[model samples]
Target: MPPRERDTARTRRTVLDAAARTVAKQGAGVSLDVIAREAGVSKSGLLHHFRSRDQLLLALAQDQVDTFAAEVRAAVDPADHAAGRLVRAYVKAIFDSLGDDTAISEHLLLSAALSTVPGVAEILQRDARQWEAAFTSDGLHPDRVLIITKAADGASLATLYEGGSNPAALERTRELLLSMTRGEGSFTG
Candidate 1:
């Protein structure tokens, strides 16, 4: 009988998904053996897909950033004409990820741990350039964009330790940020 063919794409997806779950629960320093075990593959198999631990972490980080960026881009409303449309989209994406009642919310928790990996920083910085250009050219004042985005970031941080966010508070903050983005609110009375 012939040997079974390896499903490269499915295998890579499984490995990345398992890595995300393990890394979220344990941290980036977790052993590749552990990831392989979680992934139901041998360490050799995992190494075959990723040359080294850092390489795997780098791929995971890039995937995380790219996924979040896509979420933000999708949230953008082309007809809204809001002052901070991009920032609004960003704020919406952050809240949406935190609000997810599904397994995918693990990505947010995983992201908090990904920063512990050395190669992850470069991934984030490189991705930040795209956001920088979008928000800088976005119709809102730079100060407004900065505050709205930072507030959303701080709120999203709650997911790091809590594994999720307070729904009511998160919704309220989401609305407030959206309003601020639309020039309908202010930080001061």
Candidate 2:
């Protein structure tokens, strides 16, 4: 790409990152002026990228999903051709994000913080449908897939509520969920 285009893309990313950080810190009620300030871009410059606050929020919502999906993709176990490969990777992504670091971790927590805003839920639901299909077809039983995903989700939510994650509890939950995906234990346990 050309330098100008690359600069444009970089500026867009900067704005999105700033918006996520701002929303995560200040909630959805935060103003565009603040977001632009946080991004180090003028209001006009931010508008050139996002157009409107809702547009920026919607873009942020999509960015959040994309970031987590990228994280899961990165964690995929290429050596494992059996079932639970995608799911185990997903489980890893969730637990990995609980550490309160990494850009991906911040997005996971930011997404939870933005869950109630308009457009965010629909974006999540759409992404979720795709994930559900992928999980169900990965050679795992439907029950195992559901149970494992929900458990990982609950762990993420617990991190949101608790303002951080408990390493020991997350470890235990992570162990149980990964085991279930691999068909090593009962889901009822």
Candidate 3:
């Protein structure tokens, strides 16, 4: 990439990171001035990248979704069966995120975004529908898929709220979820 483009990308990333931390710490009502200060940019500079507060919030939501999707794709294996790969990838992604400090911070940011942004919930719902369709198309039962998805989400949320979880329990849960994808175990909860 050109130096100009790299700088632009870096500026945008820095602004978004600052916005996420601000939102997570100060709630969704955090001011643009605060974010600008946090990002070490002037208000006009922040505006150059995001036209308005709503725009910035929307971008934050989309960025979080995109980042999580990339993580899931990275965890998927080409050699696995399509259904198993999808299920395992989803489970692995959740586990990976739970263990990541950045992911925990982002999760808090996401929560703030959902609560503050008008259309953010729709965006997430659309993403969830897409994942559901992909899993069903890959031959997994939709019910089972939803179960596993909700379980992972719930566990991740719990960990976020509680600061952390027992490592052994988390590992056991990961193994159980993976086994479900392989059709070797059932989810009791």
Candidate 4:
């Protein structure tokens, strides 16, 4: 790659990392100027890549979603039962992602974007449908199963971000989701 392209890539990383840290520390109200300063770059440099705050927020969410998707694909055996593999892989990936501090930032950003931006929720809904379809081949009721999955994920995320120090909690949640997916236990309260 050319030096200019490499430099641009580095700058983008710096901006993204700084944005993550800023949001992690200061919540979703963090300004681009603060992010630029935290990244050791000028505000213009940051804006060059993002163009606008909405663009930056969307990019951040995309990065996190892509990361989770990649991890799920890597962890599960697709040749196995597709539904079972997707459920197991998703559970494991959610747990694994919780350990990364930057994930909190990603979560907050994603939440803010979906709540404040029109049509962003549609993107999430579409992804959820895709996830449900991926797990449907196991004879599971995709809608019900996905509801349980999202509930479990929401609970795990709450614990993961609240500074609660317990690996057992994550493990237990993972096992619970696995059991539900395996038809070994009821997911309902």
> Whole-model Cα lDDT per candidate?
0.82, 0.85, 0.81, 0.70
Global fold similarity of model 2 (TM-score) = 0.87
Best-to-worst order by TM-score is: 3, 2, 1, 4
**How far is 81's C-alpha from truth in model 1 (Å)?**
3.8
lDDT of 4 by residue, 90-128 (tens): 777777766654565456554664455554566667766
How do the residues 21-109 of candidate 2 rate in per-residue lDDT, one tens digit apiece? 98888888899999999999999999999889989999988987898899999999889888889999999988887776444456655
TM-score, model 1 to reference? 0.82
TM-scores of the candidates in the order shown: 0.82, 0.87, 0.89, 0.75
lDDT (tens digit, per residue) of candidate 3 on 1-189: 999999999999999999988888887888999999999999999999999999999888888888889999999897886566788998998888677656676676657655667888888888888787778776666667777778877777655576776677788988887777776655434
Best by lDDT: 2
Can you tell me which runs of candidate 4 are displaced by over 4 Å?
1-4, 99-114, 117-119, 137-139, 157-165, 186-189
On residues 45-152, what C-alpha lDDT tens digit does candidate 1 reach at each position? 999889998899899899878888899989999897756878888998888777654444466568778988887888899888878888888888777888888898
Model 3 pairs in collision: none
lDDT value, residue 183 of candidate 2: 87
Error of 3 at 74 (Å): 0.6
